[model samples]
Target: MRYIISYVSTVNPNISNSDMTALMDYVRLNNNAIGLMGILIYSEGNFFQILEGEEQTVKMMFEKIRKDYRHHNIIKMLDKEIISSSFSESRSSFTVISDHYNQSELHQFLKKEEEHNPEHYKSISYLAQKFMKFN
Candidate 1:
């Protein structure tokens, strides 16, 4: 069965750009190796991420994220048994969305995609936007 989990977290304020890049690279490599498809977005000191794959795989990844020291205040926003991942269309199964992104655009894009799928999960990209507004 496929499963997806979305979460929001505060980036460690002291982390440097190079550090973040290293973190993303490490995560992307691991996720792709395990056939996970997802997006990790960092905006203005916060992170919004979604991960999807086999149920056990997704859960294991989330556990690793929870223990990761790069971020804090981890909050699981959305979790569901899904039919498929919204990110499966990407050539790279795992991607890092940072450097530049439009919050409203991202929200609308995810919302629109969700409309075409089973309504088993709620969209949390809005919360991603809301979190980015803080700092």
Candidate 2:
């Protein structure tokens, strides 16, 4: 069965864009190796991420993420087994969203960014707004 894990966390204020880019680059690579798929967003010192894959792999990844020092105060929002990955149909198996924008700007940004996938735009924007406590 497939599994999913989603969470929100506070980013370390000291993290620079280059640092995050490197980190996400590694994450994206590792995710592909492990057959993981999902989205990760960092904005205004906050993060919202979703990871889905084999149950064992997803659980193990979350453990590693918990020990990561780049972010803290992780609040897990969703975890469960699913029939399949929700991201399976997405061309970009792993999506990343990050910027210095506020709530309004972020919403506009998501809109413009996902113009190719309205289905993703809906769910992703809703979750992002909710995680930022702006919705």
Candidate 3:
């Protein structure tokens, strides 16, 4: 089984970029032990990312995030049991470009997707397009 979780945490005002980089290095090195698929950290309007493997791996990674001096208040915005991961291909971990944040649209689409796939975890990307723009 797989899970998808999107979370946010407050960055510690005192932490520096170099410290963050070192912390991320530890996370990258110990990923497999924790069941991480991918991690994306948002700071100063920029999102940093790491992708690992497994549910336990991801959970362990999140635990480290909670204790990191760089982050303060942590909150998980999304979590779900996934039938399959969108990231099975590619390296065990990688970080790169991130897309723009379109919050209202994303939330609205997720709501509708949950409604449509109440029993199964189905993709609602197209349905979101059909309904969200009209409303």
Candidate 4:
């Protein structure tokens, strides 16, 4: 069955974009080897992400992402099978440039982000970058 996985996390303030890029590069490489469905990431005071894929693929990918140091306090939002993946394929990712949310919307999104126990937003963000580059 298909599933949607949303996550949130905290990153060290000193993290640089180049470093982040390299880290995401690794995630994209690994996700390609595995079966990463769709990915989206957003950040403001903290980081957030959403991933959609098969059960096994999503679970396996989340497991691997937890070991990475780029993020801490990762949490998931939605983790159930939906009618379809939000992505065109099982290996696509996208960046959410507009993460600005109203207070209520932010609260709702965070509630969802906290419930599903996703990996890290950085991983998802990196995946989006790679996906966009390749796609």
Candidate 5:
């Protein structure tokens, strides 16, 4: 079954841009190899991620993320068995909200989804919208 897990965490204050890029690169590569697909959004030292994959694989990844020192106060916002993967691309996507162009584009994309699927676009979608607005 396909599972979706959404979580938020504060980025360690000391991590630099280059470090964040490297960290995301590692995550994307690993996730791709393991059949995971999702989008990771970083904004103002906070991370909002949505991962979709097999139950055990996604759970195992969440556990590793919980122990990672690069972030703290990890709070899972959503965990549900979904009908299909929202992101089915080969590799996981990463977006740093500092880039206004990309950030706005993502926000628009989610907003469109929210309008079309109001029921499924609940708390997680709201939280993503709010996270995108963070400076």
Candidate 6:
């Protein structure tokens, strides 16, 4: 079965731009090899990510991500089986919202998401829509 997991974490303030770029590159390569698709968004000092793939594979990845030292306060917002991946065309996509304009836009989009459907897959779709808009 397909599964999707969405979580938010506080990013380490000390990590530099180059470090973040390298980290995303590593994630893309590894996720592509493992048949995962997702989008990772970093805004200010927070990270919001949604990962979709085979059930067991996604679970194992989440375990490793939970232990990674680059972030803290990892709170899962959604975890459930899904009909399909919202990002099937890409291995992984990332967006770093550095400007105030895009950050505000993303914040509004997330707030709207909360008022929409509560289904896991739908939430993932909404997140992908917003991610594509900003990135």
Best candidate, lDDT-wise? 2
User: What would the per-residue lDDT of candidate 4 be over residues 12-110, giving only the tens digit for each residue?
Assistant: 667776776565556546655566654334354355556566788787667766786767787765677777545546225432322332234333333
Clashing residue pairs for model 2: none
Per-model root-mean-square deviation over C-alphas? 3.9, 4.3, 8.3, 10.7, 3.4, 6.1
In model 2, the runs with Cα more than 4 Å from the true position are 89-92, 100-123, 129-135
- Show the lowest summed lDDT stretch of 10 residues, model 2: 100-109
Each prediction's number of clashing residue pairs: 0, 0, 13, 6, 0, 0
Tens digit of per-residue lDDT, candidate 6, span 1-135: 999888988878888888887876687678777877665676666777877888999999999999988989999988999875555343243333333334564454445444543444465556545544554
* lDDT, candidates in the order shown: 0.73, 0.76, 0.50, 0.54, 0.74, 0.69
lDDT of 2 by residue, 1-135 (tens): 888899989988888888988887787687877788777877778888988888999999999989988879999989999874566545435666566433455565566547755655777778777766662
- Give the per-residue lDDT of model 3 (tens digit) for 22-108: 655665566534546554544353333433355665566667666866666666655566675544433344332112234454454
Off by over 4 Å in 4: 42-45, 90-135
Model 1 residue 85 CA deviation (Å) reads: 3.3
Q: Write the per-residue lDDT of candidate 5 for residues 45-104, one digit (tens) a residue.
A: 888888888889888899899999998999998898988666534324433334323667
TM-score of candidate 2 versus the correct structure, residues matched by position: 0.75
lDDT for model 2: 0.76
* Winner by TM-score between candidate 3 and candidate 1: 1
- Which RMSD does model 5 reach against the true structure? 3.4
Point out where model 1 deviates above 4 Å: 89-92, 100-135
Query: Model 5 misses residue 48 by how many Å?
Result: 0.6
Residue 67 of model 4 has an lDDT of 80
